[model samples]
Target: MKKLSLLLPIAAIPVLVFADNKQMTTVTYLDRGNLQLVATEEPSSFARQITENTPNQDRRHTLENYINSLLKANAIYNHKEGKENPRLIYQIHANNEGTIIATRSEQGKYGVQIGNRSLPVYGINYDLQSDCSWQEQLCWVFYPSSNHQKERWLEISYAPHAIAELKEGVSLLIRNLQK
Candidate 1:
């Protein structure tokens, strides 16, 4: 009974955060080392198709390598903070059925219908839970948690599209890199 009490709340985290809402959007850790969206209800065939269209590990590695190359670049990174690493960390998910689903969004942030469902999105944007921004175009932004040790990524919705955002931001970083 004692151990059971301690284990209950930990197990209930996802349920408490997700079940309260009628819409169920689930993300799981894919075997390929990425996060994949799992439909809480019956997955739409379109969503399944979108999932099928996602890039394989080999291609994904190539993209990651390219992104890594850009990190040292001038305009794209924020080097003022003294921490030189600013890399693209993606949490890919599909926008199945085109319905706006709030996976873990709270009340204030954006990124509802704007998320990159066409492919894996860069990040998400919920209200105060915002770990991302449109203007800054930073995803996987580490927001410190209670312990100040662990952090959560802010989800931001970028304009045009996730891909365009990447290209534009990279260019902006390069163009502004000299500044």
Candidate 2:
């Protein structure tokens, strides 16, 4: 009985260690006014691999490559778009710890407004949440639209960890509208 008891405890240690390591990883990315969230057993590894594989080409191509790499890494979904410049827009990258936000917008037109400032029409918005606090970031891409193209503008808002807030915010917004 004494020998059995010692062996049982030793055998259980691996189980405990494995249980601790079984953590879920989730990654969120936004592109062309769309949002994609990916969950996996090894998120950091997947993200790093994808980012590394992307080519350091021109800014526009690089951005597209990055977004494409992320899409290949996991499932992707469309979020929303601003009414104006639909093509000119932004992308968002967010994890549980921090968020990286980037924006690409047309210049010399009606400016895009985030929070209160008049950002370029094409910009990226991000909301990051942690255990103790939350942060928001934005990036702007300034380029002029061609005269041949219709002067359309688009704004995108992305929050990987803000699903709960988004649901509540939408509900409240709609509720207030009904009133």
Candidate 3:
């Protein structure tokens, strides 16, 4: 009976490890070819900026709502949402190889989560121009300037809003994912 008890604990180790690693999710790769997402942060020379005026509280709230809806839709479709961890967004759109993860943990750090490491956001660019292949032109690109590696960087794309509103949405995603 003693051997049986020892074997039971050993078998449970894998389950416990998996439970602890539940935060890891399937990595979503950005299809640059399909989306036509350019890596430039500059305003398109041919296309004019959509809006120069800053977004007010209402506008920002609306943008956040839209982004949240998109996330919820994806989560629901994938059946990844749960009562314990309701908001299962972010971390889906990692870099090309899924090394740099987008994260906003419960402690309030916002940026990419690589492996077991967390970094902070230093710079984010919002390209709001009518130059996209699709109907919408609000392109949000996040370039997290981390000291981890100069050659390696991160790009997170999702956009269509005023600069302030885009920031709000990005903040919301980064915050919600790691929770």
Q: Which candidate achieves the best TM-score against the true structure?
A: 3
The Cα RMSD of model 1 versus the native structure comes to 20.6
**Model 2 stretches with alpha carbons more than 4 Å out:** 1-18, 21-41, 44-46, 52-64, 67-84, 91-155, 159-179
lDDT of 2: 0.32
**CA RMSD of all predictions:** 20.6, 19.5, 21.8
| Per-residue accuracy of model 2 over 1-179 as CA lDDT, tens digit each | 35553322121111111235776555555555466555556333332343356543333244334453332222222324434343334343322222223333333246643322222222222221112112423211221233333231212233333333322222222222222
Per-residue accuracy of model 3 over 1-179 as CA lDDT, tens digit each: 35553322121111111234443222223453342222323323111221123233233334345544544433311124334432223332322222324343221136423333333322422321121113332233344443322221221222333333434455543433323
lDDT of 1 by residue, 1-179 (tens): 35553432221123212554555655454444454455466333322232255455333333333333332232233345443433222332223232222123222234222233221222322111223455666543233234444353323333333333334332222222222
Q: Model 3 scores what on Cα lDDT?
A: 0.32
Off by over 4 Å in 3: 1-55, 76-123, 127-143, 146-179
Model 3 weakest lDDT span, ten residues long: 9-18
Score residue 145 of candidate 2 by CA lDDT: 37
Q: Against the hidden reference, what TM-scores do the models get?
A: 0.19, 0.23, 0.24
**What's the residue-level lDDT of 55 in candidate 1?**
50
